[model samples]
Each structure stands twice: as C-alpha cells, then as structure tokens.
Target: MPREITVALVQMAPELANPEANLRKMGDFVEKICTEQRTDLIVFPELSYTGTELGLKATDLAERVPGHATNYLAKRANEFNSYVVFGLVIKEKVESILYNGVVCLGPEGDVVTDYRKV
Candidate 1:
C-alpha cells in the first residue's frame, strides 16, 4: 500500500506582541482544520506567533522553547492526533539572546524538532 498524509497550511495575521491571542487563534485554526478533515501535519507561516514587524521589542516578545506557545500548541496537537509546525521568537537561557525559531510538535504533544532561522 502507498503511504499518504494530509497537511494543512494556515495563513493568518498574528497580533503583534500578543502571544496568548495568537496561540488562541492558532488553536482555533487547528481545531477547525482537524474537524474538517484528517490532517497529519499543520504548517503555519513564519513568525506565526508574533507579527512580522517587531523592531527592538522582539526581545520582550521572545519566549523559551517548550514555553507558553509550544505548550499551548502541543495540547491541540495531541487532541487532534496531528503534528503542528510554527514559528516563534525564542529566548535563550542566558537572557537577552533571541532567535527566530521554528518548532514541530508530534501527535503525542512532544517537541519533535526545533530550528532557528539563520
């Protein structure tokens, strides 16, 4: 038998500096997509959790990996039994250091892979 998978590409406008609101929006999209079809993976645009224009305030908007955003998305992933991929501003443990990062969450609500934009 041939292997197959369903993927969802989400396009939306993220509210600047409001991670919580963005997360809610993302969760809504996931729920809507998963409800409509059986999806294996969902992909969101870059900086999906934070708006594109983040001047110097990007630092304040930055969060650690497995932080609020990932945790929130993970629940949805597990609930829907699908993988979720999205971008966010990641804060380093040393503080003051941040990167544009992408995360992939497994169907079990675990971090599968994390990549930082170069």
Candidate 2:
C-alpha cells in the first residue's frame, strides 16, 4: 500500500513592507487551519512570511538555513502534529543576498528540507 497525506492550501493576503504583521498573520492563519481543518500537511503561498513586495535588504530579514523560522515552524509542527511548508527570505553569504525560499518542517521539530528559489 502507498501511504499518502492530505494537504490544505491557504491563500493568504499579506501586508507588504511589513514582515512582523505578516508573520503574525501567518501564525494566526496556520493556527486556524490546524484547529478547524483536517489535513496532514499545510501549504502556504510564496513569500508567506514576509510578503513578496517587501523590497527588504538581504540582511534585514535573511535567516540562517536552520534559524529561528525553522525552529518556530517546527514547534508548530510538533504541536499540530502535521507538516508545514512556507516561504521565507534566506541569506546567502557568498553574494550577501536574501534568496526567496520555502522551508518544510517535520513533526519532530526538525527541518525536513528547504528549497531556495532561483
């Protein structure tokens, strides 16, 4: 038998140029989905954390590959006992650029994986 997981996609509208509010919004949205829905995984839109039009500098919100965001998301994953995938701004030391990326968190409070957008 092939094992499968259910997924819920949240199409959220985030405020541009304001990552703090957006992150809070994302947290709230995630909480709502986990509480009210039935799914094994949740997928959020691109740049879900910071929004797409922030125009932020690399260092402004760039996070280490396994930094706070991953840890935070992982905690949620543990609490909800579900996998999550959300977009974020990640730092690249070589070019000092913040690459848009999506990180996946496992239920065990571990970074399951991350894909840096080109």
Candidate 3:
C-alpha cells in the first residue's frame, strides 16, 4: 500500500508578544492554503505566536494546553478538515512552570497530542 500526504509549512514572523495578531495571521494562512489545495497537514514554526525574544515576558505569554491558542487553531483545523501542528509556550497550573511545547490538532479539531520540550 502507498500513501501520500500534502503538507504546508508556514513560515512567518510573529509580532513580539502579540498573540492575537499572530493567531489571526495563522488562521489566514490556513484558509488560504486550504482554499488553494487539499492539504493533509499544516505546520507552523516554534513559538509562532509569541516571538522568541520573551525575556521575562514568557510567564505572561505562557498558556495552558487547550487554552486560547489551541482553541483558536482547533476551529481552523475543523473548518478545513486538516491536521495542524504548531509550537508555543505552555504553562501548567503553577505560574512558574513553563515549557516549549508542540501541539497537533486533528481534522475534527481535537488535540491529537501535545509534546513538551524537556
């Protein structure tokens, strides 16, 4: 058996500390890619939402899994019926706990898995 998948790698410069803008841009890319062709997977750069120059702002930018960013991207995944992968800063219940993480969203908009950078 042979299988083939179409993947889109999105490379964009995120606004420093501006999650909302970054999310919107990502969604735009998703819509554009899906409309242009049938894509099986879409991948975004690490720390795509929060630019890598966080300094002490990482704490404020960190979010829990299934939080705002995931929720936002999940909608896009379901809308286009494609898998989506992206990286961001994740935080646990405790304020100081944070990890560089990657998340994969399924076609149904459910989280397939989340990986934390150790």
Candidate 4:
C-alpha cells in the first residue's frame, strides 16, 4: 500500500503587525482542526504571522528564527501531535536584516525546516 498523509490548509486573515494575536488565532484553528479530524500536517498562508503590506514596520515585526512565532506554533504542534508550517518575517543575527521565510515544526515540537524566500 502507498503511504498516505493528511494535510490541512488554513486560509486566515491575520491581524496586521500583531504576531501575538495571529498566533492565538492560528492556535485556535489548529485545535479546532485536530479535534475534529486526524491530521499529519497543517499549513498556513504566506505572511500568516505578520500580515502583508507591512512597509517599514516589517523590520520591527520580524522575529528571530526559533523566536516567539515559531515557538508558539511549535507548542501547538506538540499539543495536537501534528506538523505545522507557516510564514513569517525572520530577523537575521546581523541587525536590520530580515527575510520572508517559512518554518516547519514537527509533531514533537521541533523545528524541521526553515526556508527563506529568494
């Protein structure tokens, strides 16, 4: 038999510039989905953590890899025993440098992949 995977795509309107609110909303979605069905992975839209059209505020809103946004989602992944993928603004170690990136968290709440948009 071929292997199978269950994936859920979440289309959400995240509050602009508010990572905390977005994370909470995403967490609710995750809980709701996982409660209702079996899911191996859940994916959110680009800029799901930070809304689009950021302009200069993007810099201020950018998060470090393994930062608040990822950590928050990772915990949810662990809670629901599912993989989660989402997009956010990432800040580099070098000050003021940032990238558009996607992070994937495993079921154990560990980061599996972090891909920066080219």
Q: Model 1, range 1-118, lDDT digits (tens) per residue?
A: 9999999999899998888899899999999999999999999999999877898989889989889999999999999999999999989897788889999999999999999986
23-118 per-residue lDDT for model 3 (tens digits):
999999999999999999999999997878898999999999999999999999999999999889999999899998999999999999999999
Residue clash pairs of candidate 3: none
Candidate 4 runs further than 4 Å off: none
Model 2, 1-118: lDDT tens digits are: 9987788898988666567787677667767888997668888888787777666453576777788767777888778888888888888765476788999988777889999988
Candidate 3: lDDT of 31? 98
**For model 1, which pairs clash?**
none
Off by over 4 Å in 2: 56-58
lDDT scores for all predictions? 0.93, 0.79, 0.94, 0.94
lDDT of 4 at 89: 93
Ten-residue region with minimum lDDT total, candidate 2: 50-59
- Error of model 3, residue 2, in angstroms: 1.8
Question: Which structure among the candidates has the greatest TM-score?
Answer: 3
| TM-score computed on alpha carbons, candidate 4 | 0.97
For model 2, what is the error of residue 48's alpha carbon versus the real structure, in angstroms, after optimal superposition?
0.8
- lDDT, residue 42, model 3: 99
